[model samples]
Target chain A: MPLSIVYYAKEFFRGEWARKFLAAKTAPLVTPTYFRNYPELTGKTCTHHLFCMMACPAPGAIDVVRTPEGWMPRIHVGHCIRCGLCVEACPNGVLRSGRILESMFYDNTKLSFSFRIDVDTERCMGCGNCAVACPVNKLIDSQMSHGGRASTDDLLLKVNEGKCQVLHVEKCTGCKTCEHHCPNEAIHVARLLEAVHAPEDEL
Target chain B: MTVLQSLKNFVRSKSIHVAYVDVGSCNGCDIEVLACLAPRYDIEQYGIFVHNNPREADVLLVIGAYTPGWEGKLEGLWEKIPDPKVAIAIGNCPISGCLFNRPHTLVDPPVAKHIPIAAQVPGCPPRPTEILSAILSVAPTVFKDYEVRK
Candidate 1:
């Protein structure tokens, strides 16, 4: 017992174990390079083959929606698991994520995505399809007094001043419910991919 | 409130004990809950502890659709948690059954039909941060009024 104790003590104090212990304590910890990140748009044209949607394991995580630019895959962040399967499944290089797809992108702490609503003033007939179909707007203005009309200004978007105005862009969750409800396809919700921390003033 | 009572309120509001249940989900929401427990989110930093027993839970996180197997079992589980308990629906499944409560699926439409839900974190399976914020926002108000209840 004494011999074993001496050997263990020496190993703990001066052997490889001590070096390992110190290294472990001082090593800079970082997320694995291969760790899956949220899939992002690559600006490549989407064939809309629905491979990404089929491969996504999380429910309501990915969907192919029609935009004026054609069919594009929309990632619902709330439901996304970041499995990277959708990234692997895309036939075209449209959706990108994971170390396999890593390129000379911004090396930053956060890579977030935000959706911005773009109203085609020329195409928008002020029909209020998007305004009426927005779930948050409905919740905020439940008493939508008139048919397809905002009863109050406390809404995410409204058909005010004879045009659909986005009152609060921050309220957009990228669910794209409004995009689907648009009959003339006037309202466009596009995912704004941010690879690095934007300036506070710009935000 | 007395000093002791106020102190209790402070502690109770800051801390929460959550019990998780998976009625019949595809395990997607449960995985997200697991992510909340992991160090990246570290819900313990906010004084949130997760366990399996509803008896010790201040908040009940309901996942998945109300499956047929949990028809009466879910209610029994809810009754196990003491009063001043807040039930949080942690996914779109529990809120509206997402893709489960189809035309004639063997699941209930919404969990609220069986239990009183205090909050609904609506996502197919919500992000861990979203779940954390939901719990942090709801647990305090629900437990603050505990000691004062007649």
Candidate 2:
């Protein structure tokens, strides 16, 4: 054991490993460029097209606010899903992140599905059963916890003035719970599957 | 203030022990954390070590939405960690409950109500780099001035 220790000490003192050791210690692994980094503003100015805001799936993720230098899109880091949809939605070269835009042009296809709730007012009796069954409604509005008759303005949908009103359609998870609970069949939740593609696709 | 004490403190700060807890998360954040430990992210390069035990940990990683199943017991879990410890809430679940915050669900979000959070990394499940940065920036502050306090 002592002889082995002496041999290792001699090799260490010879200093072949010192340079490699220093280099390894000084440098660390970097996040890959293809990684979906947060969106950053480029030299191209924002035109307030509001396309980025529409494309963002996460609520409050992207907002076109009037900054001191005019209208610009502000990305809320805490809420952003980093899905890169906002980067693709910008008409001008205002925002860029990773290779999300390049992926759209290549054979890589992006698929997005959205839910649209169509309520037929003619057949509606305003029972609020769908609202009571809605998972989002019961979670957001504590008043709905007991029954759906509560008048809170935060619910996804509620009975107001003898008719069912959809408050926040964006909050729907497309669970179809509301559609299943509606006895009158007035509320119909339709799933819209759309393919994401480049705006100016030649082929 | 002695030389030996300062050296010990420096050595201790250089080596950080991290223990993670999942109160009620969907394991998305846990997957990201696993990536952090992977060779590409390599959190250990910063001298951060991860294990499941909380007693020896200097940093506690809390991931997940506050679920009903963990109710009345999360506070007890918080007490297990030794002092000079920092809790980093990873992903949006713990930050705001994210998608799990919705109806018919048993999630009680904003995990800060139960445990004190030193930092937060927000996303559906944040990138591994974000988790690495969160631990690197926050852990040292709690261990700062170790000998002086003693």
Candidate 3:
């Protein structure tokens, strides 16, 4: 054959061809990047000091944008390191650090989805208000727990007996009834402003 | 069907420059709006560009509930924006002030009472797609309105 053809064949075998041939033998699992979820909850009496923006370490992760009301913190998901600093800085427990499956993140543009509630375990006084107020709580079968022994209703009423624990986060609709009804303000519901999805085009 | 109409449609569909203005809104709608500029939503795919200056904007996106002091400033900004422009009120703040519409000293009236809203996207924080669609739907009407006036 020709010398150029031989050379080109050699280069392909050494570079992309070798990788593709090897890939046929063993496929590697590509780990999706995990995003630290921050619920963008807005409330009636929020002080709006924007200390969360101040606490962020990553540049452009949390930007302070001035609206007509006042300055508010806006998170840039692309730049966010998911360090959870902004969540810690929020005095009102407005921000909560959670993990979201980047691939499982849905588009809220078509159908609106609220953020799941994150309970500050330390702050929770085992108040059963969240359990009682939860709309999904009624759906949770009481017999599902403890070898089909204890009912959810019994557990909810006695929720304050020990410590309030968030049993099922996925079941939460982000209705924020628990957050609203909580006297101690232990529960913080996530407010989703942007749709969570892998970027279509990476800039 | 006609040459002039086709020419106008081509220009209208070619590019849309949007300027986002927040009066008294929680940063929720702003975040959603900014997401459209990000790689995920990427409104640029539709030839829509989020511009900073009102002078170059084809569409003015006014987000937030109106407050007392900002009336003069907002009106001034509105005046600065050139004609044949569409104004979209994104999120509940501009429409009804959402939760902030409480009878209080700081809260003002809605944006509709001040500047004429060509379109309204109502949500506590409207989805980026909703905002995008609202802009698309209203842009043609705004252009047609301008053409009629001329």
Give lDDT tens digits, candidate 3, residues A1-203: 69999998888878677766533232322323343444464542335645565555544567667677655667654345455666545545445455322213333111123356677778877647667666566566433332222345333222534566666665665557778888898878875534324334321
True-structure lDDT of candidate 1: 0.76
Best-to-worst ranking by DockQ:
2, 1, 3
Which residues of candidate 2, in runs, are more than 4 Å off?
Answer: A1-7, A14-27, A43-49, A106-193, A196-203, B39-46, B103-105, B147-150
Better-scoring candidate (TM-score), 1 or 2: 2
Give the per-residue lDDT digits (tens) of candidate 1, residues A1-203.
99999988887887578666633232333446565556789899998656676556666778999999998999875456676767766657688776745432233223344669999888888878788888888788877643356667678888876678898898876668889988888899886544444334434
Q: Lowest-scoring 10 consecutive residues by lDDT in candidate 2 chain A?
A: A20-29
Interface RMSD of each: 7.3, 2.8, 14.0
Candidate 3 chain A: worst 10 consecutive residues by lDDT? A102-111
Candidate 3 lDDT over residue span B87-136, tens digit each:
88887677766667665447665788889888878655666777877877
TM-score of 2: 0.68
lDDT digits (tens) for residues A101-170 of candidate 2: 6776585454454678999999888888898889888788756742356757878888888788888888
Best by lDDT: 2
The TM-scores of chain A alone, one per candidate, are 0.46, 0.49, 0.34
Share of reference contacts found in each model: 0.07, 0.36, 0.00
